[model samples]
Target: MPNTGTPPLPDTPDNWPVPPPPRQEPDQPEPRPGPNPGPETPDDGVPDVDGPADLPPNPPRVA
Candidate 1:
């Protein structure tokens, strides 16, 4: 209980200490078109995966 050594890792990666520039306008505006309705789009007879089992090609507009 008399040896704590363990703290040294800074040779590259941009000096390291850049964490103060992240506030690009996002207080309440910019969420009127991004919720769910993203995956699961297999209609039109269903058949789009391709290979081994085939069935993967119905991506023209998911959501």
Candidate 2:
């Protein structure tokens, strides 16, 4: 006959070390706008030289 030893008992939850709670960072303030801010409008201050109508018609395709 073979003799087998009993297995070790599992660790209890109470014996385990408790970890500390996570720290929270304070909210940061947004940066103020610089003196030379970009133009609000898409065109800025430049005038449009040529309109769509001013362009010449497309030449016929050479098929």
Candidate 3:
């Protein structure tokens, strides 16, 4: 076959041109905390309930 003038394909992976590294995005600033944040505390104005303690105790089961 006659040569087409184009360079022959690389036989090994090492012969190929290395690709450019991926672009990196700029770092974002952390958010600032407001007056009140996170979970609510008992002293946050609303009264706290007794929860499970308010329920009646279970009776013992006989064999």
Pick out the ten consecutive residues of candidate 1 with the lowest summed lDDT.
46-55
Between candidates 1 and 3, which one is better according to TM-score?
A: 3
Which residue pairs clash within candidate 1? 48-55, 48-56, 48-57, 49-55, 49-56, 50-54, 50-55
lDDT for model 2: 0.56
The true-structure Cα RMSD of candidate 2 reads: 12.3
Alpha-carbon lDDT of model 3: 0.60
**Candidate 3: segments with Cα more than 4 A from true spot:** 1-10, 29-63
lDDT of 1 by residue, 22-55 (tens): 7689678775754554555555455434313245
State each model's CA lDDT, in order.
Answer: 0.59, 0.56, 0.60
Give me the displacement of residue 8 in model 2, in angstroms. 10
For each candidate, give its TM-score against the true structure: 0.21, 0.25, 0.28
The 10 consecutive residues of candidate 2 with the worst lDDT sum are 47-56
In candidate 3, which residue pairs clash? Answer: none
User: Residue-wise lDDT of candidate 2 within 1-63, one digit each (tens)?
Assistant: 455686655798876779787876658866776565344434434433332233345799999
Candidate 2: stretches off by over 4 Å: 1-10, 29-43, 46-63
Per-residue lDDT over 1-63 for candidate 3, one digit per residue giving the tens place of the 0 to 100 score? 898999987789887889999977659866775554345444444443432333335689888
